[model samples]
Every structure is written in structure tokens, then in C-alpha cells.
Target: MSTATDDGTREDAPPTPTKKQRRAAGIAEEASGGIKLILVKLIGLGIVDALALYAAFVLVMHEQWLVTVLVVAVAALVNWIYFSRRKLPAKYLTPGVIFLVVFQVFVLIYTGYIAFTNYGTGHNGTKEQAVSSLMASSLQRVEDSPTYGVTVVERANELGLLVTDPDGEAFVGTNEQPLEPATGVEYDGDLAVSAEGWKSLQFADVLARTDEVTALAVPYSEDPNDGAIRTPDGQSGYLYVSTLEYDETAGTMTDLETGVVYSDTGVGAFTAEDGEQLLPGWQITVGFDNFVRAVTDVRLAGPLVYVTLWTFAFALLSVATTFFLGLFLAIVFNDMRMRGRKIYRVLMILPYAIPSFLAALVWAGMMNESFGFINQVLFGGASIPWLTDPWLAKVSILIVNLWLGFPYMFLVCMGALQSIPEDIQEAATVDGAKPWAIFRLIKLPLLLVTVAPLLIASFAFNFNNFNTIYMLTDGGPRDSNAPIPVGFTDILITMVYKVAFTGQTRDYGLASAYSIIIFLIVAVISIIAFRRTKSLEELN
Candidate 1:
């Protein structure tokens, strides 16, 4: 055997490894990847172990800090696992990945939960916000109350000196009737007031060779016209005023400023007991009352139904017309022989380039019944009822939307058309298929597969196109007998805006619920369309 140099060296350090040890090491290395994996594992373990040890030390050192220590320890453990643990997949988290994943997941779930609850701008505040608001109001102590627009102070001396209201309110004490000294008290000095505070001396301090005595204290009643009154303790009275008063007993508050009486019925919101509703401030929930009113109230439902149907029909027709027009334009523009094709394409996309609101408004003005340019040109002396008539209003919305939407489909179709192999079309042509036959049998079917997603997207967009409906006729011609206050051209989105927010009392809870329901409807419809189109197979 050869002896090794001895700086803590062991000559018999097992001579590498036996066959069994070598096999075991190989197995471990394969299971864990390589040296890099082993190092990562060790580092992660070290971090967790160190944090655990620190947490244990904190727990032992400070028993009362259980929640804080445990929270810190758990956070460290999570970081360690997120950084190095191999149980979870890598795609779930990448390097420098966030360790507080639970927090994000919790927030998403909480938001979804709020959609179901009556939680919104108009509804009552959440429990936590309400509690915090109450605590803030209750704990606030007014040091000196604003009474009779003046500040009256009783000094240590028995002198009764009143200061004029610095806020420019009418004053009680003046130069003619200066503050009087109380019977038992004496005025020690001239009245002096500063921005800091009022200052005066006791009568006892002025008397020489007299034992030091505290100043006289005089109590006076506050002015009756003002909101202040004398207290039973005979020293000071509390000026209890609530800018927003909540009568817990009656669950109502008479707004001192607006003179509106708002009543709360537990869940969230304070509504005026009187028929008149308040606006432009905090919204209160009225439970299912808004929904009931929306459904049963004929004034709202009548117009709502008409507008809803028109909205759906418009969306459907818009998608169909835009698709066919776009396909036709794309096919024409796809020909390589067409001169200045790029220019034609750019000109076609001009409508899409313009803001829809501006375009819609401009279209409205041009189609106006009285002074419209189109009416003047066509009817000459006669004018058209573009906005007044219900059918005409619906036609106007569809026409403008179709003009705006087709360009987008045309652009998408052009790109998708280029992707189709030219050989496929040539083969069809060679097999005795005419141009329309080739397009219908080969091109159209293939194009549908590519453009189906965009079709669904376009439909969804048109369904909620509020700007077009709002600017055109505002859902009007005002059908008085309609279920709700609805217009001939009103869509769901536009109707919801007018009924829920435009009214005197904003109904936020119903609005939130309606939005959530609409979202669900759209999502379901899209899913169905995707399944029917079998676009997922193409994507996969």
C-alpha cells in the first residue's frame, strides 16, 4: 500500500467505491439528473432548513409571536419549494418564478366570488370597508367643537372671555360688550389670541403675596341658533354631527345637504324611502328589486325586448354580410395579375381605420331626416326619417357596422387565402371544375376552417356594439307601451346602459349581474361555435 500525505487525508477513503457503491451512485445520479441537480437540491434544502431553524428560534424566543413567525416560516418554505423542488412541473413555473402563487389564485377566485354577491359601486360596501369606515368615524374625537361660528374658552382664572368667530360668521361678543369676568374669577391680563391658541393668566397670579391658585373657570351656554347646546356635566357639550347619518334604528338617514332620506335594508345600499331616487354618489343595493322591476315593469320590458331582438338580428346579419363581402373582395384581390392591388386593399381598409364612434356619428348626421346631405341629394325637397322611424334606425346601424366590419374580414381572408396551397386549386381546375365550383368545393370549405374563429369574434363584437346604437337613435322613437323604456334600435348593451345607469337611481348590482350573465352567454356561444366548426382540431 502507498501512504498518502496527511493533511487530514485518509489513505483508506474506500478507494473510490466498491462495485455495489458505484452502481448505487450511478442510480442516484440518473434519478436526479447530474451534479447541477444535486447542487440545486442541496441549495434549496439549505434555504428551507435555515429558514425553519430561524422560525424555530423565533418561536422559542418569543412565544407570543406565533402567527407572525409561522407566516414567515411558511413563506420561506414556499419560496424554497418554488425555487428548487422538482415535484411540480417546470412549465407551471419558470426561473425567478413567483413564490406567492397562492395569493394570485386567491385573488382570481375572490373576484369571481364577488360577481355572484351583491357587491358593486351602488350596493353596500363590503363588510371590511364598512367596518373600517365606521371605526374611522367613531374613534375621531373633535377637540374643540364649531359652535355659533365662534370659539368660547373658560380659562383657569374665573374670567369669561369670548373670541370672535374667525371664520367670518356673525359674532356675539364685540368691542361694546367685551367678555365679562366671572363673579369668583378676576381678569389677569389683556385678551390675546393667536393662530396657535388663546392665552390668559389667573386672577390669583396678579395678586401679590397670595398663595398660587389656579385660574377661575367660567361656563357659558352656546348660541341657540348654532348647532351647539350645553351639556349636563355643566363644563362642555358635545357637537355630535354626522356628515352622513345612518339611523340604525330606522335604517335611514336624512341627508343634511340634499334633504334626501336614504334607508338601508341590511345587505348593501341605502335607498330613498320616497319614490325619487338619488344619483351621482355611493350606490346602494335594493336586493332583487331591480331585477324584478326590470322584468315586471312594462315600461322598461317593452322596449328592452324589441331592442334585444334587433341587437341579435343585427349581429347575425352583420357577420353574414361581412363574411361574404370579405370573401368576395379577398378572392378578387388575391389574383396576382390585378394591377395596384395593394392600393385597392388599402382603400378598402379605410373604413376600419376610422374610429367607429366618429364614423357612426358622421353617418347619423348625413342620414339625418331634416338637414341630411343624403336626403337632400336623393329626395331633393323631401327628407328621410333616418332617426325617427324604428325600422330606418335599425337599418342605419346595420349599414354602418357592416361597412366597418367587412374590411377586417377581408384582410383576414386575404392572409388565409395565401396560406392555401396553389396546387390544390390547380388540381381542381384540371379536373374540369369551374372557378365557382373550385371555390365552393375546395376553396370555400378550406377558407371557412381558417376564418371561423374570426367570424365568431366578429359576431361577439357586433353583439355588444353600444356606440353605434347610442349615437344613432339612443334606442328611441320612445315606444311608450314597450315592456321597459326601450327603443326600436336598442341592443342589449345600449338598453342596459340607459335603464341601469342613465336613470335617477343607478342600479349597480343588477348591472354587475347582467354583465356576468352576458359574459357567460357569450362564452358558451363561442364554445359551441368552436365545437361545431371543429377549429380545435386544426389548432391542435
Candidate 2:
């Protein structure tokens, strides 16, 4: 390497620039050249962008795909344009902001708009689907249709159906047998007529044979107008339908033999003129029915309301108790000179280390009413009603939740306490401030500045700690007197579980509605907590 001379320039006795300096100066020149090259780069980018947009239009709209593709493609293009723009970082942020505004804000508001209307199970039917499902039709039941009792006689892989009538007439039919009618009858080794040449018929022949026949003494029952006839035993019925007439245009079905018209009313179900509704395919739109049911449905409202209150109470108590105990423990353990402090700290954190659900289950067994240690301690040989009673269950839940939660607070406090300057406490002590005065005036205010946010977060977590509530009590004792099968220990989420899924089948729409409500509540609380923390930060 050449050293610089006193003139402040490197002197290797060279009159020309070195390759390294030329490259260094070239990089500097490149940096100072500004966005002149960037413009050309942007122009190329624009050409590529134009090609992509054209391709997207051709592939999305002009292709066989639905409008959804076009929407997504345009959205992607918008994001690309915003990200590629050589403006400020805030300018790039505009696309994300617009996306969230358009989709999350507007689309979500639109969904809420739809939710207010009749949007539940039956009401999910589109206008076209509803109209099609609600159409009307005519049914006809033809009488005296030729009918026969079919008995499948199978040996090995080959199968044959023996068709018999009430008059002891019999004919052997196979897969090739179309709707061919037999004229001769045979019974008990007596042939009423000699069989002419055997006729080989196709399967379609039998299906197309619509001629009415007399009812026979079969084991099942069927409609006489159609090939459907009932047997004397009443265990089964045989009914043959022609065209299986369903009026897709009218949204109704017609029995071609009975002349019965089943019409769809779009409310309740498909009702015949005689007021008999079909088994299914009926869609109804009852406005606010779900909300009304949720309020009035004894099964849901009673448990839901009580559980909701308990949920709030649990969250509040859990926060208050955990905070105080944790803070106290944190203060005691914060002393640097405390003996075996590391061991004690590790032991204190054991509760958090243990899986909470497993711990809860173990505790539940220990608190069991039949043969638990609590009963032995309290009643010499009997158990306490810890799990059975409502109040006791709530209290037990709070205790268990405290054990699971306080360790976290302690850990946070320990870290925050270290950051509190010793000088502040020393100054307070020297100024005649008492122990409480030092803590209250100096340590606590500083601790709050750090831990207030954590406190709010803990509150939020405890608010939705479904596992704790469920694992502890399972909302028990079968409150049969209550509207639903809710227990005293139940919370809102558990109540929702019971109301939505414990029935004969799951009710998804009602569950979705309840979830939306809970989401709104959590969102509002989070926003409030965030703002409050911000205010505290500002104060600090």
C-alpha cells in the first residue's frame, strides 16, 4: 500500500489514477447520478406491468373464469404498482392502507349488513335457488297399473327376480328383462297355458311398461294408483314412480300416478294442498328469529346470560388477585443478596413450567368430592363439595388460574424491578422517606411505567382463557332447571359450545353470530387497553 505524502495525496510516484480509485470514484458518481437511470428502469417496469395487466385481463375476464378472478388480479396489480413506486415509504404504504380500508372495513361492513337480514340456514338459499325450490307442480296417481311382486333369487354371481301375482302366476326375470308383460300363469306344477317361444327383453322394457295392474297379497304395501302397492304385513311398501316428477322451474314435485301437487312456500317447507309438507328441501327466512331465539330460547339464554356475567367476574378477579400476589412476591424476591435466591426463583417459576391443563386436571382429582385430601383434612373422612357447588367451583377456578398466571407476572416484575435505578431508592431513603414511601413514591411509579402494559395484556389473556375454565369445572352439575344444559361454572365460550354443537346437529350460523359478538368485545377492550397504555407512556 502506498502512504500519503504531506500534500495529503497518495504518492507511489504515479502520474495516473489507480484502478481502485477509479472504481471508488465510479461508484460515487453512480450514487450521485440520482434517478436518471431509475426513470428508464421504471419505464421498463411499466412495460412489464402493462403486459402483465393485459395477460391478467385475457386470462381472468375473457377466460371462462368468474368475476372473482378479475377482482383478485386487479387487487394484486394495485399492490404491485404501489410497492414499485419510487416515492416515500408512506407512499408504498398507501396500497396496504387502501386494501385494508376497502376489504376489511368495507367488505366487513357489508357482511354486517347481510347479517341483519334473514341469513341463516334456510335463508342461505339464493333468490334463484329460493324461487326454484319454491315452485309448484302437479302429481297424478294412475290406478289399475299392472304390478308384480319381485323376489330376487340369487345363486352364485347370477341373479334372477321371480315376479309373482296374487293369482299364483309366476315368471322368471333377469337383467335383460325389459318392461315385458307376461300373459301365462303357472302354479303348483300346473301351467295354465303352454309357454310360447320365450321372449328376451331389455331392462328398458320393464321400466317403460306403465300399464296398471291389480294389487297382490305381497308382504309390503304400495300405492295402488302407481305400481306402488302395500303388502298385508305392513313392514315394507313398493312404489313405482314415472319420471320422478320434480318441478325445478316451479320448485315442487308431482306424483304422476296420484295427481298430488307439492308446492314450495319458501317459509317452513313444501306443502301439499292438504297441508302436508315434504320431508326436506324447504327453506324459511325468519327475520331476527335467531337473536330472538338466543334471547328467549330457554336452552341458550338462561345459561348464556349467567355464564357471561361469571366470565367477566372471573377475568376481573383473576387479574386483581394475580397482580397483587405477583407484585408482592416480585418485591420480596427482587433482593440481590437473598440466600438461595436463584433456587427459589426457579421453584417459583415451576407452576408456569408445568402444562396448565395437566396441572388443572391433577388439582381437580385432588379436590374430588369422593376421595380427595381436602375432604380428609376438613371432615376427617368426608369430601368437600368443591366441584359440585357453583360458588366453590368459581373460587377453585380463580385459584387454579392464579397459580397458572402469577408466575408470568412475577417474571415480568423481576425484569422490570432490575431496570429501576438504585439511586432513586437511595435518594428517597436519605430524604427521610419511609420504606412504604420509597416504594410508593419511587419504585412503584417507575414499575407501573414498565408493567402497566403487561398488566393489560394479562387481563386480556385471562379474559379468554377458555382452557382454564373448561378443564377446571366443565361447567357442571347439569343445571337441568336452567334453560340449557349449562353448569354453574360455565363461561360464554362453553355456553356457545353447548348451544351450537350439543344438539342433534350443529348450528353453525348461530355459533358464527356469537363468535362475531365476542370478537367485537375483545377488539374494543384491546383498543381501550392500548390507548390507556399509550397514555401511561406519555405520562412517563
Best by lDDT: 2
**CA lDDT of every candidate:** 0.60, 0.62
Task: Count clashing pairs, candidate 1.
Answer: 22
RMSD of each: 14.3, 14.1
TM per candidate: 0.57, 0.58
lDDT of 1 by residue, 165-217 (tens): 33432212211122332222222133222112233323343343122211211
* Model 2 per-residue lDDT tens digits across residues 1-540: 477888899967556678999997787555435577567646755765676566667666445465446555655655465445343454447557767977788766654454344444445545434333232112123354444455333223333344555454655433322223344533334322222234322335433332211222211112211222322221122433343355667767665557788776655455788888644343344556655665577766667777778878888899888888888888899887789888988988899999988988888887888887778666787867888887888888988989998898888888888998899888888888999988887778788888887777776777678788778788775687885557888877777667555755445456546656766777798788778777656535
Off by over 4 Å in 1: 1-147, 151-299, 482-485, 535-540
Report RMSD for candidate 1.
Answer: 14.3
Q: Which stretches of candidate 2 lie over 4 Å from their true place?
A: 1-300, 376-380
lDDT of 2: 0.62
Per-candidate clashes come to 22, 39
